[model samples]
Target: DMYQMISDDNPYETPMMIFPASHYTMGGIWVDYELQTSIKGLFAIGECNFSDHGANRLGASALMQGLADGYFVIPYTMQNYLSDQIKVPHFTTDAKEFDEAEKAVRARIEKLMNIKGTKSPDQIHKRLGHVMWDLVGMGRTLQGLVKALAEIEEVRKEFYTDLRVVGRADDLNTELEKALRLEDFLVIAKMMAIDALNRNESCGAHFREEYQLADGEAARNDKDYMYVSCWKYTGDNEKPVLLKEPLNYTEIKVQTRNYKS
Candidate 1:
């Protein structure tokens, strides 16, 4: 019920608090050892980048990655980058680029608010969440995936026409914030669903309904799908770039994962 409220296909009526559903990767910008993103003079450390986790992440490794990047990596890389720039030039808030970026942000918010739709933003968010939780949340199957894709399309249609935002563009509105986040979540949710559907065997968090052992445990087909699937988002209509990063095990021999006693 809680998950439904925050991630339902339709807008939620009662207010609810949503927990972090899965991995958090909002911290990485395009950074070097200095932990900087593509933007010059900007730095990102901790859980923000794609550097640490290679496909399926292990527990407690997040802490190590954060410490390594912040304490060890960034200091050295930042020093190298900063060595050449002795006197840094300061730019005012009214700079042309800054103004343009700010204007763009404001305009986007305005557009969302001005959308005279019948369905509320919460409605679309809930529908998307339901699809993700049911199809790509924990377990998956081909049939579920097909259903999820169809449901997502329906919800997306509602998002553009029925979805409503009840707040001013300039004000600090939590509802508007939620709407924007939902948009990103919807995109990511589909990616996860597709990734799970394409993977035939079960591995790590990806558990396919058709792929399981006789003892009722997840079965891995390492021979066929022992590589990490990396997806790059292209444009809206264009297909994503699919890349493979193979996993070779030397220290730990390949063995079936089991927890049954």
Candidate 2:
């Protein structure tokens, strides 16, 4: 019976394995109407900007948004911002700000190299990947999220102590690069858990097991949670603070979607 059904219109076998993983984060650095981030003199576009997609992007929309922002939006908006600065003198690397930024980066690199502990960056990252995949990915519960947060802290501690990176920082060190990237990922993972914990209601890709309806579908709480979450980083190892911008729809009425017909 299964073979007959499969032979009717399907091109592959019935039994198969489906693996899940994060494709892209629709939530990213928030941008304004002009495609500029909150910080002045800096701009972000494409997958890095959060303004295009709400929580979950569908199909080819990511490509379309990227192209439109690159070709149409930024060209005009950035020109306006740059119009007044045309007469400004070019900045030299000898400037204080540049020196400080470079020094900070070098110090961070040295710190990572000096650890010289047992576990490699890849090992710690693999443990982190498991924590994220199991506790924070797809299915989520309050208990699981709390566990993930705690486990992330423990992994972060391990990373700071046991992280081993071979090669010199002055040169191109692939292991150092991975260690740095993993360092960033650790913080971002914590932020994810925090945001997930704050938003008790489920919406888009951020599904919470405690906020489901009788039909096992996500139950959105628009009355209380219709806002974009923004986080402000405060120093090293401190918890990020949250700020919300309420979503306002003037032309469209918010309604539940039905895909079954």
Candidate 3:
């Protein structure tokens, strides 16, 4: 892109794109004590697995999680799981299960390629992004969240039915990649809105407009809703089941945060 002549020519000038990210809400995929996800061999480490940080994670803590997960944690934990699998025999891509999975993936790709719509994946994705930002990004309310869910559903429907993938699936197709990722992004956006709606009280990154005090602060209802709410993905356009893992504090007591000085 620099060579494409859109960026600042000067070396001392600011870069093309820079942004703050991953400070808060550093984790999402539910993992066990050993950082293993529901899929047996698939392990989520560092920020990928929901652990290590409080609701609002400071930037510095992500560094520790990264180091700990990469260096110390995943090695011992993954090895434990792998040790048992040593005698299970190595399976290649030619296996029956892998063949079926690959066929399903190729079928999805063909479906996207066959959509033959006018809008690019980027265009549809941008529209989806705008909907999320305006409706569900911040200053969220009951009505807004509900509307966001509706909009996201439309986006999801549009993605599957109207998305145009410009390149061949057999080749290295970046547009196809974007289309696939956009599908997942739509899922995340909907899940976020759904979870926001489920949790009645405002807490951390989820700042519901209805769940606020007169002085304009988050009113966290620990007595009723103090728990890690994990989601079970049902299907496209179906409501995700809310799986709540209640937080029972043993070492410390629950305390309200007073942000006002």
Candidate 4:
């Protein structure tokens, strides 16, 4: 399209490569009004925080969000938390308390290196993207979600067992970094599928095929799912627990959104 715009060629008539993608669909780490996460002193801002937008992010919302957070919001809110830590001492990375933590991280990296697996972190990442897009993205279904869970679990196993890295962990290795990130991404993917499966209702961007109106619109079950779901991670072996905080619309009316209007 950029080429078409600059040149004399027509945009539609010219051959163009296209890639389908979800544009800021519903999902982000939960945070309070001050952009503070459940963990104390930790903050997530802008796109990282799930404070704004209940479902779909409106056009130019990200722009407005960035402006509000960067210029107005976080500067004031973050100070409210930082003022309490004026007397608190900061721990450096080389601190004695970080010894156990550092050891754990090093041990994990060593375990990954010793696996001597065949697949690269990049390869598994692509596979994971496809799995998420096909099974967990857009139109989520019960059967598909269940299948995705199983497939993701298997993929997770494959990562630990047959992974291969280009360089040593102690060196400047992007592959090792990617492997660490992919490990976390796999966890998040599982959580997304679990959230989708448990909801059992279609609301906003989360469209479950089984739950819809006669007019082919999203059908929200306010009675049961009238709340924000908070998932707590227990461990890699155990299922996450679900917590709900009910939403009350005292001033504004809540109802199904008809895009046709």
Candidate 5:
């Protein structure tokens, strides 16, 4: 009865919209054994880093992953890297690097403000949400993925030129922030689309419709795709390069999941 009260189709009486939305991503920024990112002096933990969870994480395990990384893993592993950075002095607000970064941000904000377009960022993002939901949400196919990529690119162009942001760069404007975030979302959307296209097999939550068996179960091509697909940012609107790290299974034999049995 309690379960039925919270489900989409409650046989017991109450019905609700309980379908899965974008909540967890087993795919994330790649990290090494030390939880260190590709960039030195940078580290990622928990859901942000693509570690521990693999491509498919079991339910209720994300909290454990976060706790382990925060309390146990990072404390020990980060010291190894941070110990070498003791000599580097603290940076000043007026430093050249800081100034350059600030300038870049200012330029971006100015561009957003000066767009002078009709559609608001939120409107464009809603359209983006629809695009992702239909093409890359759950059931994916090669043809759908290709179309999604093209549509996402169109969205990106429209976002830059047709965007409307009515706020000052120097002032506290939530709309401006939301607009900037939408820009990032578009970039990430494109990258995800490319990644999905490259991965021909269906493993974990990334189910490619074309890569399933006769029984509609996921068909994994472990021999060819038994490696991590890491994407590196090249430039704005440029294609990302995919690097692989082969997975070696010495202890356990990988097999299809059996939920019915």
Candidate 6:
């Protein structure tokens, strides 16, 4: 493992090793050139929105993309949005919508606190991580994916019912925050699994066990699966809508992707 290789305890340091963890998100809220989502008021940029990167993200592009979106895109788009909203009066926090939103947030926190569970939130999170790493971590297959989905379902159920937190609701509790973040990670992990499973061919960081070259290199099926898979989250019970945006390669011709000569 990557962690073990990097650790001080390890005698022989390997130059390259697999360190699988919940890293970058390829898909997020759909956005336009202006970084605006489908909702008129909402705007998402950087890693939060699935805009720039297609299937495989290039190195050193993340910084460039984030800066470009933040400095150029957002400023220009906000100007356009604000131009129309200049005459509109600013709403106060005491407004019904704001009050309702606050109430809902508070209620959620209260509900989480009320659950007197035996297992700590970390315990549940560790199990989730193990499940994901075992089945849907590096290379994935149909059997492994199905098993992972079942395990994830069980973890989610345990998380909601048996998870515990140690802190007052008012104060800044790091544990509670971690628990919330872990919950979000769980949802995100599920989406990744679904995306990986649906995509039968291997491409970029997404490597399917069933699709690979004889030498272990990822084989891209551009003719069939050369499209960005954008998933829209509906709700807890509802299935995510899988949207495909086809890649148009005009300048560069389709060629074999290889790092080694």
Per-residue error (Å), model 4, residue 169: 1.1
- Ranking of predictions according to TM-score: 4, 2, 5, 3, 6, 1
**lDDT, model 2:** 0.83
* Candidate models: Cα lDDT each: 0.72, 0.83, 0.80, 0.84, 0.83, 0.77
Q: lDDT for model 6, on a 0 to 1 scale?
A: 0.77
RMSD of each: 9.4, 4.8, 6.5, 4.5, 4.0, 5.4
**lDDT per residue (tens digit) for residues 86-188 in model 4:** 7998778888769988889999999888999899999999889888989998798999999999999989998988889889888999999999999999999
Evaluated at residue 139, the lDDT of candidate 4 is: 90
Question: What is the Cα-based lDDT of residue 205 in candidate 1?
Answer: 64
Which TM-score value belongs to model 1?
0.69
Name the better of 5 and 6 by TM-score.
Answer: 5
- Judge candidate 5 at residue 88 and give its lDDT: 88
lDDT of 6 by residue, 147-226 (tens): 88888989988988988888888899887887778778778878878888898887766778889899988878887888
Instruction: Name model 5 segments beyond 4 Å from true.
Output: 1-21, 24-26
The Cα RMSD in angstroms, rounded to one decimal, for candidate 6 relative to the true structure is 5.4
Candidate 4 lDDT for residue 248: 91
lDDT of 3 by residue, 207-243 (tens): 7888899998888998889888889899876778888
The best candidate by TM-score is: 4
List where candidate 6 sits over 4 angstroms from the true fold. 1-30, 37-61, 64-77, 250-252
Residue 206 deviation, candidate 6, in Å? 0.9
Per-residue CA lDDT of model 5 for 62-101, tens digit only, reads: 6788898999999999999988898889887987999999
Regarding lDDT, does 4 or 5 come out ahead? 4
